[model samples]
Target chain A: MVERWPIVGMGAICSLGSTARETFDALCAGRSGLAPIRGFTTDWYTSDSLFEIDDRDDSKDRPGRATGFLLSVIAEALTDAGLSDDLGDVPVLVGTGLRELRSVELWRGSGAAVTPAELHFGAAVRSRFGAWDTHTFSNACSASLYALSLATDLLSAGEADTVVVAGTDSITESMFGVADRVQSIPPDAVRPFDRERRGTILGEGAAAVVLRREPGTGGSPRGWVRGVEVNCDAHHPTAPEAGSIAGAMRAAHQRAGVTPADIDLVMLHGTGTIANDLGEALAMREVYGEDLARPVCTAMKSMTGHTSGASGLHSLITALQSMDAGRVVPVPTLEKPIDEMSGFRLAREQAVPVDARLAQINAFGFGGINAVTVVEGNR
Target chain B: MSEQLFVTGIGVALPGADHRDAVLDPQVPEPVDPAARIGRKGLRYKDRATQLALVAAYEALRDAGLLSDPDDAKSHVAVDASSVAVIAASNYGNLDSVAATIDTIQQDRSTRLVSPINTPNLSSNVIASEAAIRYGLRGPNLTVCNGSTGGLDALRWAGSLLRAGRAEHVLVVAVEPDNDVVRSFAGTPRALDGAVAMVLGPARDEVDTKRPPQAVLSATQRAATIDDLLPRLGVDLTAVDGWYGPGGAAEHGLIGQVRPIELGHDWGTPSSVLGLLQCVHAAARFAAGATGTLLAVCGDPADGVYCGTLVEAPRQASRALTAAGHDAHR
Candidate 1:
């Protein structure tokens, strides 16, 4: 069996809340962060709705918004983990679909004085935390989970005792515009697994977790990451394949030395798109078959919006918090769920009470990149 | 836990290097035409970096005897397609595509003019995923866009995958295109317009018993500085014949008398592909009959340094030495 890494600390900044605890509480309360886009003018686009974080504190308005978000989240995670601000030789692994693309967009459009080096978080991370090494993964939406997998490998390979895995992304005009153009009609909000779901809305924020080989002085670890498996469909660029995703899920379970019956909760990569929901639902069926209802499924995007690369850690943090509270966060916007998920016990409307122990989080991205991570709660 | 990993094949889509032998030549040649090297059939919508990666990947696969024909879609390797993985490293793989899409949006004030077919390239993993899709490699595919240490990090991950029995063979490709979009961000005097690829597999593989290995990867490590890295290598530096890394290896007082062959100074600034280029050059030197141990290290003081040791395979070493003697006599 693979060695399990402990997640000692976690911090999340999203539309729902500015901290992981706040986000979890808000999720349990079934509060949605979806609102009309206020960062930019969506006059020419079909969708004006997005899950944008309120950055009212102008002091947080760094050159790169995403970098600022990441730094803040990292600080919180470090504080939570009882780590010093100076990381010494510790490595930082950051995952993002578009690293500072929004900053680049601003520079290109308005001729902002942002240098090319600012396009990535390397300089920013080094300057702020004095990390010795930083690795950035741009694996689309599944980026963070991939980073998490690499962090696990680093720990297992004796490369490092502790690794900080972070994922952050702000909505870029190009991505927002593409989403607006692709969706013929704009949906009111992100509705995962809903019968009338149109597509995912772009969200902005960051999430981070501190993983250590041994549980350090950070009280009790939030959860233990058993295994993380990443694979590609190699079939399509945008559309996800059920067989490939199912294969990844099975591989993850095998690596974790567990079976589908052992999983008590599942965090679905339900993007609310027609293809994504169907593809995920099909893969879930292939894995659990008739016993799909045993694992209580939940989709965090319905409340957090699609944070893109950060969604995986967002979902992971939510899962751990739910396990601690003995409740499954609901998809407040999911009403009249899709028929493909008919047999699955998808949490909806109200947080469901359960004795959740082990949870599986799914993060699928464009280019058919899929990452499945199985985590066991310490509670 | 360091298993026996061998460099079975080496390929380069470098400028002025038509064959693997010329990869180490200092003279810069004319720009490489990816269409001529590979094919133009799937060139549309692919950025220059992806195209270069394809050319290098094709050559590496063929060199490793994994592919019978580059044009044949049904060409199969002895191993299952699902058992092969592809790992690519690039800092700005999709910069051009992203710039174009954003430019179109800025000009038209909408994304209606952007081509949907090119949208997938916006994701950085597209470089590695496209290679997997083209070659039908269904195993774990990853693209490392980290800082300068990305290439060595890719190698480390490949080793981890192999040790864990996740993949039988891994195709590692590192590319950097010297285009306007890249130049704008690279801020380097010369950005490398090339791609380096190598096929890494277990030394005890059953399928290729007859083939002589290129070199055996002895160890790989990442540390905050050269001082921290040398002791971790676990290899005797006095017996090491050559070193391929930054210029300050001798100053570190660990490399002994071996003058470091700095790749960045010889070649252009390769950024993320620097570490892989170092390995490629070391492999070439080994293939040319240079004996003993060769070390390839890259990365900066800020991002830490990554180093790997390559040792000559026993059988290949004898053959290479004999060939070198024969060439010397002639």
Candidate 2:
């Protein structure tokens, strides 16, 4: 049997909060991290509001920002899990869905005293975290979850007893310029699934999870990553392919030994972009078919914006909060649901109370990359 | 361990090589026109890296019977498009496009000059994404940047996905475009830039027209060093037929010790996949009944470990098929 991976600890740093718990609480309270860019600026396109990780010194270089963000969350996760033993040999996998901000910065820097390793952001992270052996996944927004998938494979295959799966990316001037050029940034707020939704606001953040090899479940309930399914569109570079998205959902459910009817809630890749909303809604329908018993859905992108590579973990942690609170958090400004949203309940305005047992965190990105991870809560 | 895998087909688009007729000069690096070989439609906007990967991926697919002809690609796919996975591996990424866009903006001082369509090109995964789109491979599309072994690890990743029943077949492609800027930035001596692709299938299958396979692969794992990497094959390399090294500055003395049959003479981590092409080419030269094993190692300091795969030729692939058929008949 494939070994089940138990979630021992979780940590995150984003504009929503510096800690995962804080981020969860803020989302539950309907707080949005959208604001004018503070730490980063661009000349060609400067006014794009973003969910910037405030509080870090503005003058800090690119590597400093990214490294500090990653280490802070990893420390929190390790502490939360009570794993104090040496982690020198533990298998490590870090993912950056997009290009590493530091690599972009170093390349776009003044080109002085830049070491060769600095050009490879994965090496810098390895050096700082002392994870001499780590695999880096760079599959766009689904990167961290892919990293999670790799870690799960390691644990299931008995290659490692413990594994650290982490992801981090800070918005850079270049990133901002690209978003602005592509017109992906919203003019106002990120209103996912709303008729008035414009687009998503790019954000900066990091997330890490400590996964221990376990059979099914025999430990204190931190959480359970039952399984994750990944697939690609083979359709478009930027467009979300509902067929593959549906394929991933079906694969994840099949691997988790659960039927579509077993899903209690869904945290979608609701980037507030109409294309993504329509695509995801269609995929959900494809998975659930015409079943009357459909799961309620929520999106933290309304609160935390699009954290890019770190968005999947943010949604996972947020769902964990809902499981603990016994309420599905609502998306702000979701006054009118889009026409494509059907077969599932949309959580908006106020949090909805429900006894949810299984939840799926969805992350989709450029290259038609789709990832669906099933998590078991203490419901 | 899950079911064994066979290297059913390989596609290579190296600097002085082409997989069309299997001509490999292995000379100094030079630019190759992917558009010329693969056609120019829909490729005008892509980077050299993406184009190179697409060419290699198509060749590999054709070699594996997934594509019937080079002239008619979309109509010729023989495998289930929905059940095929694609994994693109690279270490340097598409620096050629990044540098080009940055240089253009610097020169023009206007972001307007850069096409908005190019925004997606900033990602390293774009190479794999393009391959999937062009080839209609909807299975687990992955992009790996694990230093030297990213290429092999991609093969390993595909193997695991296949074992888990995620896909029926997997296409693994690795590409590195020659960038003078990156070469000078690293102060490396070589201009190694090319792409290599492989199509892997289950060992127990009698689905295709070709022989079992050129080689069968063991599980891919991370080893401490070159010493640990090769021995994991459960045999001595001196007794084996050959070795292939895509090691960078981190693994200096490894080549002199292993004495590879065909020295890749390539630098950088992505070239490890190119080394794979070299190894496969040499193994194909073996007499039909000849038996041998080739150890392919790719490592870099950034990766901090060697990732190797053990390939057994005149491989035990037939044994796996026979056992499966025996069970079926019994």
Candidate 3:
């Protein structure tokens, strides 16, 4: 059987909240963080709505907004894990879609004196936290989950006692422009699985989880990462294929040593786009068939917006908090659910009370990269 | 440590080198177009890095006897399509595409004029995904854009996938293009414009009598420093037949006792392709009938260091040399 890695500490900063606890509470209360783009002028694009954090750190030493978010979340995670900020030899694996691309754009747009060394976060991470080593994965939206998979492998292979897996992305003009052009009319709010959903709004934030070989001395583990499986569709660049996604989900379940019946909750990668929602729904049907209603489903994007690369860990932290509170957060903006997800019991309108334990989180990215993670929450 | 991984095939698309035998050439040659080496039928939308990676992957697969033609849609391989994986490492693979998109947006003040073909190229994983799609490699595909240690980390990830039974064969490719954007990001006047690919798989007992592995990867480890990593491998570096590492290792006093063979000295400072280039050079040395083991160390001080030990395959060293088309005298 595959060994399970314990998630000892987690920290998240997104539109909903600045901390994981605050985000979970906002999610339960069905608060929406989507608003007009404040970080940059979105006058060039028709779609101005985005989930952006309000906290600003304009220090001269700060490389960029994305790096600031990443460092803040990592510090929170380390502190929550009862570890010193000076990570002696722990390997930090970061997943980012567009690392410092926004900073580059800013530099090019307005002669900002951003150094080339700030392009990659290795130097920033080393200087701030004194990390021993760092590696960054840019697997699109599913980047962090891939980092999580690698961290689990490190623990299973006895490579490290603890590994920090983080995902961060700030909305870039390039990506936002692409998203704006792709959709005929960009929607004001993210509405996952809704029939009227036009497209997903871009969001910015960072999320991190600390995985340990054993329970750390700081605190008990939030949950155990039972298994994670990653695969490629090799079909299309932006469009997702259902067959490969279903295969990844099955592989993750097999690795986790769990059956469809044991899962109590599922965090869908519901980007609310016509292609993404329909593809994810088709993949779920292929996995569960008639038993899809067994696990309560929720789409965190409706509240947190599409966090992109950080969405997987954002969903993961939300799932753990749901299990703790015995309530599944609702997809607040989900109304007139799509016909494809008719049989699935999606949490909508209000939070659902349940004794959830085993939960699965799905993160699909551009280039047909897909990652599925199964975690077992502590009761 | 990995469970006896083997290097079965090697391919390169370096500036000065065209074939595996010339990968370690000291003289720099004129720049060659990747589309010229590989066919240009489907190379219109692909960026330079992706094209280079595709060329290298095609050669590597053909070298491994898994593919016959790059244009053939039905080339047969020994393993299943779903059992092969692709892992790529590049720090600036998508720089050109991203810069083009951003520049277009900035110039037009809108995204309506952005080319649809170039939109997907903005994704960093597109290089690896394109390789997988071209070859129908459906297993775990990943792209490493980390700092200096990305190449070695890609190798480590391939080992993990193989040991965990996720893939029967893995095509590990590392490419860095020499473009203005790349050079700007690298903070150098000139940067490495090359790609290297190696097909790695588990070393099975029932090896084909006719074809043998080029080398056996005994172990790979990473640590803050060479001093902290050496004891973990439990191998005597002094006894190894060859040592390949960065030039900075000599200053750190890690390689004072041993003569380190530094590859890519003239290629400029490579970001993530240095480690894979080192491996390709070592494989060529092994195929040329070098004895004992060779160590390839890669990484910078900030990202730490990674060391991988490659031992010559004992029984099939002679046959492997013939299979790789290496001149035994060279």
Candidate 4:
């Protein structure tokens, strides 16, 4: 097994509050981040109840775009982690589902100037933290976790003692248009694992986590990355083979040196799309078997709507906070859970009482890319 | 646990031909004549990224003596795919979709040009996924996009997996297509199209018969800046046999007489893969006693240069030795 790497700090932004504490409180109160479609028109759109940022101030000198939103949230996350914007010494690994939609729009509109990578991450580091080593990761949904895993490698390999892993994606017209086409976004209400669930609502936000080899005397160790494993179906560009989903989970557990029994709960990617939900359920069943009393499964999509690349961290942040608070988050909108998938425990509105310390967060995306990260409270 | 991750086999498909051998000994495939690989039937439809990766993945597996049948690649995992995350690192995700959408939008009309291919392909991760599908890799399919460092970055990521006990075998593939957008950004005549892949696994006492030879990865370190690595690497520039770098008069005096072989000259844009191809070439040459210790430096005029070296051992040494008359000082 690879040496166990530690997660020294974390940052997150979603429909919830800008701070980790605020977001955690909102989650405990079961506050959903979903709302009516305002980012774009939904007159004929089939989905509703997307995770939208409320009271988003567009008055800043920042241009009105997805990037602006990302920068704002990243700023808030950096503050929480007690880090500057510069990432020179530390590798600044940024993840996003849709990278620079503004660049895409400009390229489409007037063939205008495109933003350089420096302008994005490079400039962000220079302007915010002062100086830093940086790189951008655009792997669809699993991008952030990939960044986290890389951070683990850097620390484990002694490349850097500390690394800043951040994930950000903005909601733009092009983003919605694509979401509309895929039918992954729902018209209203974010409901995951609901028998009548339709699809996910695209949400905009950024999340950051400061990973260090040694967590100085400060910081909470509620949720540390035990092991991270990534896999592809090698089958299709957009869909994952059912068996490989399980393979990915197995690999994560193997790397983390833990088992399904060691897991206390699981944060499902739960895109709210039928295929995604079913696929996740099948993977859980494959790994946990018919033991319905096994690891409790919950999802954050209802609370955060689909954050895309940031979804993994969104779930991770919630798991970390919930673990510290000594509670299990309910599967927010599971009106009627599927019966055919007759294994695994499902969380209700109130936190499920449990003593198990381990948790698993599953993030899968287009091109059949899958990553599973194991987390446990600091011993 | 930090054993050598050997390069058992290699596969390469360049401008002129496809082979399971290294091309370094003969000299960079004389800049593709008409660049025959460029506008071919299926090749035209593929984005430069896909084409570069396809060629390299196919060739790398072939070189490792494993591509004859689909089954040989089954246990392999894509180490680069997980580098960034998932679908975001796709070639279809970035170039094709954005380019098409941009083209359609410039018309002043609100035209929609979204396709599934765009989302999966433009993404930086697509190269890794495509490699997995092509080779049927079941273990650790991942991708990493760190710019100029991507090629070696992919190699290092695979090497880590081997060191950490993640997989028994891993496929490390790096391919960059020379898209018009990327080329214009680089402000160059476009690099050659190519792909380079290496099968990395732990060093073994006995060749398990189930696996290939073990090429140990001694060590790799990135400098805080270019200067920090130069003198520390023990590189004796004066004793060098060849200098493989960019083409054109602009880069002429950058390194004297070494005659920079523009692998991109014939290939156009996807030259990153050529770096690996160059490594294989050096390996073959060293094996043939034609040259010794080859230095491959790659970078855009804008960004600083990044160097990759292939140190040949014993009989497998590059042809540089015999070619340079085994001169201690040339």
Who wins the TM-score comparison?
Answer: 3
lDDT of 2 by residue, B38-118 (tens): 777878788877888888888778777677464664433666776888888876657666666666666666465667777
Worst 10 residues of 4 chain B by lDDT: B84-93
On residues B1-330, what C-alpha lDDT tens digit does candidate 3 reach at each position?
Answer: 334567777788888886677875645666757768876777788888898898888878877767745355334355687789899998878877777777888788888888776877887888999888778888888888776767777887888788667788999999988888777656788777888898887553366755567667654566667666555445565555656665423344345365666564477667788877877777777667766666666766544445444444444442222221111001
Which lDDT tens digits does candidate 3 get at residues A1-379? 6678888888999988888889889999999998877765576888877888876553122239888889989998988888889985688988988887777767666656666556667777878888756777888899899889888887777767999999998888777888787776779788899999988888888999999888866557899999999888888878999989999999999999998888999999998888999999999998988689899999989888888888899989889889989999999899899888989999998999989999999999988889999998988
- Residue-wise C-alpha lDDT for candidate 4, range A1-379, written one tens digit per residue: 4456556566667787776778778777777887776544454344554676664454221223445555665666556656666554566777777666545555445454554333244345434554435556666788788777777876776656777777777664455555665674434666777788877778867777777787657666445778788777778777666788888888888888987777887888887777788888888888877443677778877777788877788788778777777777766777788764555678868666666577899999877878789987664
**How far is B138's C-alpha from truth in model 3 (Å)?**
1.0
TM-score of the A-chain for all models: 0.97, 0.92, 0.97, 0.89
Estimate, for each residue in B1-330, the C-alpha lDDT of model 1 and write its tens digit: 444467877788887775566765645667879888776878788888988998888888877878846455335455687788889998767777777878887688776887777777777778888888787788878887766777877887788778667788999999988877677666666677889888898663455676666777754665667666666565456656667665323333336675566443345667777777777776677667676666677676544445454444435442212212111111
- Cα lDDT tens digits, model 4, B110-192, are 32445544556544466667666656665555655544544544555565566555556566665554456655544457544
Shift in Å, residue B204, candidate 2? 7.3
Assess each model's interface with DockQ, reporting 2 decimals per model: 0.34, 0.38, 0.41, 0.28
User: Can you write out model 2's per-residue Cα lDDT over A1-379, one digit (the tens) per residue?
Assistant: 5345778888998998899888877777888898866754345563547888887565444444665677777788888787763466676677776545345544554454444444334465556555555666787888888778777876766667778888777775555566666663435888888888877778888888888886324447567889988878878888887887888888888778888788888998999887898898888877788752478899888887788888888778777768878888888768888877844688887778978878988999899988889988855
What are the RMSD figures for all models against the true structure?
5.2, 4.5, 4.8, 6.2
* Rank ordering of all candidates by DockQ, starting from the highest: 3, 2, 1, 4
Q: Enumerate the chain B TM-scores of all models.
A: 0.87, 0.82, 0.87, 0.67
Model 1 has how many clashing residue pairs? 0
Question: Scored by CA lDDT, what does every candidate get?
Answer: 0.79, 0.71, 0.79, 0.59
Angstrom error of the Cα, residue B234, model 2: value is 3.5
Error of 4 at A310 (Å): 2.0
